[model samples]
Target: MTKKVAILGAGSWGTALAMVLEENGHDVRIWSHKAKQADEINFKHTNKFYLPAVVLADSIKATHHIEEAIKDVDVIVFVVPTKAIREVAKKVVPFLTKPMVIVHASKGLEQESHKRISEILEEEIPESKRQAVVALSGPSHAEEVALKDLTTITAASTNEDASKVVQELFMNDYFRIYTNDDIIGVELGAALKNIIAVGAGALQGLGYGDNAKAALMTRGLAEISRLGVAFGADSITFLGLSGVGDLIVTCTSTHSRNWRAGHMLGKGNSLKEVLESMGMVVEGIATTKAAYELAQEKGIEMPITAAIYEVLYNGAKVEDIIVSLMQREGKSEA
Candidate 1:
């Protein structure tokens, strides 16, 4: 059974997902902000800006016009970055019809509002127009996914039926999809782990080895779990793929944009310099601010995230931050 799926965004993740859906025999129409990108996808069968080497399926089409992308689509997958979700949602709203299931593949909270991506979607899309909202997340990276390598991810929503539908739409032999009802936990796990990945990358860039990286990943989960629990997420969610699994992969993998950006920062490049050079959303930088703000508001202790905040915003040297974290008062691990 083929379904019409509108994918909002054409970045690496979006293009990878579009490929996955197209492989699953769905009609995937991708909406790119840049007309040139849409043209490349439609005419050249490649998204040169993101997944350069991979050729997109001919079944997957691209359009710069939001109206064309969403027209008659059964499902809408929002793959834009966290900061751009609201703005893009607004632009797509006029084309939205009633009873359409919306799936957000983005991972992060709004910077100042601290709202999850689902919440942002709900706020941007009217209630009458929304049928179901789902969040897809896990340790999967776009580069690996684009190559059709084995990958697994979770699809979560308050609506079980919608999650099942999404699971069916994306699940395949090479790409596995699990359905979960804990939308908040799933979304938080997806968002918070990036912050930890940044810390891990920083450690690696500072000449640390596996032992140090392992410790950082372990303790990073603790910080992420604390914040998630404070915000009413299930503790066990952090132990799953979206949490610990994602934390490990992003921190260690060379393909992680966030980790690479942090690595450059740890090697003594300024944030502006690194971001300008990379020319893509690092995510963890904005997520650091949101996590720090959430911790302050909820009165939760997240030493690792706090330290990252200091390094990123307060001009604390990465070396000094690492030393201070190591020298902090020790406590029994629960």
Candidate 2:
């Protein structure tokens, strides 16, 4: 069955997903905050800055007006940055007249509230307008998915049917979707792994090899699972696509802005310089702060996250932090 889908962002990921929906024979309209971006997408069928050298499907349309884009869409996929999730949701509220499957592909906890993306959507979008809130997340990169590479992701929601709806809407030969009910784990895993990705990239930037990367990734999952379990997430979800899978790809891939930003930082570039240079939202940088604060408040011992946080926010040297991490008291790897 065909569906009308409103994607509320025009970044690389948004454009990539639009391609998928267009290929799947759905009516896809993207809402960009910038009129220039929307105009480019409409006139040239391209989002040059975000998805460089890639032509978007001619059938996929874009508009700056939120109301216009979402007027009658069956599903609303929020792909904006974590900080902008609430703001965008508020803009969509007035335009929403019917219930829709509200899906968030943006992965990061809100820095101010330390709330997950779905929590912000649920808080901002009225229940009368949303049939269910679903989180679509995994290791899949926008670049790979745009190239029609084989990718698998998870659609998680408390409402089983809602997740299945998302699975059916997105799954294709190149892009496969699985359903999971662990929304808490799914969202948290999606959000928290970015922090570890930054750390992993830092390791690479410091000339560390696979052994170090492997160690960071392994212990990173342990701490992520610890904090996530504390937040009532299923422990096993950490082993699945949204957790370890996301952590692996984001940490190692050049396609990851978070990893690139961390690499810059590890090479001794300032955070401001790194951000300005990338000209993209590095989700891990902000996520480190949120996860650090949340962990401290909840008394979770996330040493790696704390180390990354100090390096990012406290002007701590990456090498010194690395040394400190290595010198920490030994403990069992449970």
Candidate 3:
């Protein structure tokens, strides 16, 4: 069945998803914020900004106009960066109709509002015009996904049918999709793991070995689970694909943008310098603020997140941050 799929954002993840949908025998329309990017995908079949080497599928089309992309589309996949999601949602809201399943692929909560991507979507889009809201997340990296490598991810929604539909839409020989009902846990796992991946990258940059990375990842999962539990997510969900699975991959993989950014920061580069050099959005930076704020508001203990926040925002030296984390009183793992 060829369904019309509209993807908002033509970044690496967005483009990779569009390719997946196209390969799944669906017609995909992608909207890029930049006209040149849209033209590159639509005409040249190449998105130089994100997936430089991979050629996009012919079934995928691109446009700068939101309405053009969403009009008559069966499913709308929101793939814009977290900071830009609200603005894009507002732009698309006026054109939306009923029975449109919204699947958000972006990770990270809103900084000040502390809203998840689905929450923002609910607020921006009218209830009468919305259908099922779904989130797809896992350890899958956009770069590898674009190359058609094997990747596994979970599609979560309150609506079981919608989750299955999404799973069918994107699942392929190289891509495996699982379904989950715990939307909160899925989103939290996706967002929180990036923070830990940054910490893992910092360890690597500081010339630390696998022992340090493993310790960071393990303790990082604990902090993530604590925050998720505080937010009403199931504790077991943290052990699933969206949780520990994503964390392990992002923390250990060199392809993670958040990890790479942290590596530069650990090498004594300024935040501004690192971000400017990276060019792409490293979601963990903004997510760290949002996660930290949520932890404080909910009275949850997230020492790893707190340390990253201090290092990124308070100009704390990497070595000092490490010392502070190490000196914290240790407790038995429950």
The pairs that clash in candidate 1 are none
lDDT of 3: 0.91
Give TM per candidate. Answer: 0.98, 0.99, 0.98
Q: Compared with the true structure, what per-residue lDDT tens digits does model 2 show for residues 1-334?
A: 9999999999999999999999999999999999999999999998989878688888999999998999878999999999999999999999899888999999999987899888899999989999999999999899889999999999999999999999999999999999999999999999999999899888899999999999999999999999999999999999999999999899889999989988988888999999999988999989999999999999999999999999999999999999999999998877
lDDT scores in order: 0.90, 0.93, 0.91
Model 1 misplacement above 4 A = none
Better of 1 and 3 by lDDT: 3
- The parts of candidate 2 lying over 4 Å away from their true place are none
Which candidate has the top score in TM-score? 2
lDDT of 3 by residue, 205-289 (tens): 8999998998899989998888888878999999999999999899988789999998998888999999999999999999999
Q: Which one wins on lDDT?
A: 2
After aligning candidate 1 to the native by TM-score, how far in Å is the CA of 87 from where it should be? 1.0
Residue 257 in model 3: shift from native, Å? Answer: 0.5
Candidate numbers, best TM-score first, in rank order: 2, 1, 3
lDDT of 1 at 62: 94
lDDT per residue for candidate 1 within 1-334, as digits (tens), equals: 8999999999999999999999999999999989988998888898877877898878789999999999999999999999999999999888776778999999998988999999999999998888889999998999899998999889999899999999999999999999888888889989988888888888888888999889988988998888888778899988888888788888899899889888888888888898998888988999999999999988999999999999899989999998898999988999
C-alpha lDDT (0 to 100) for residue 60 of candidate 2: 94
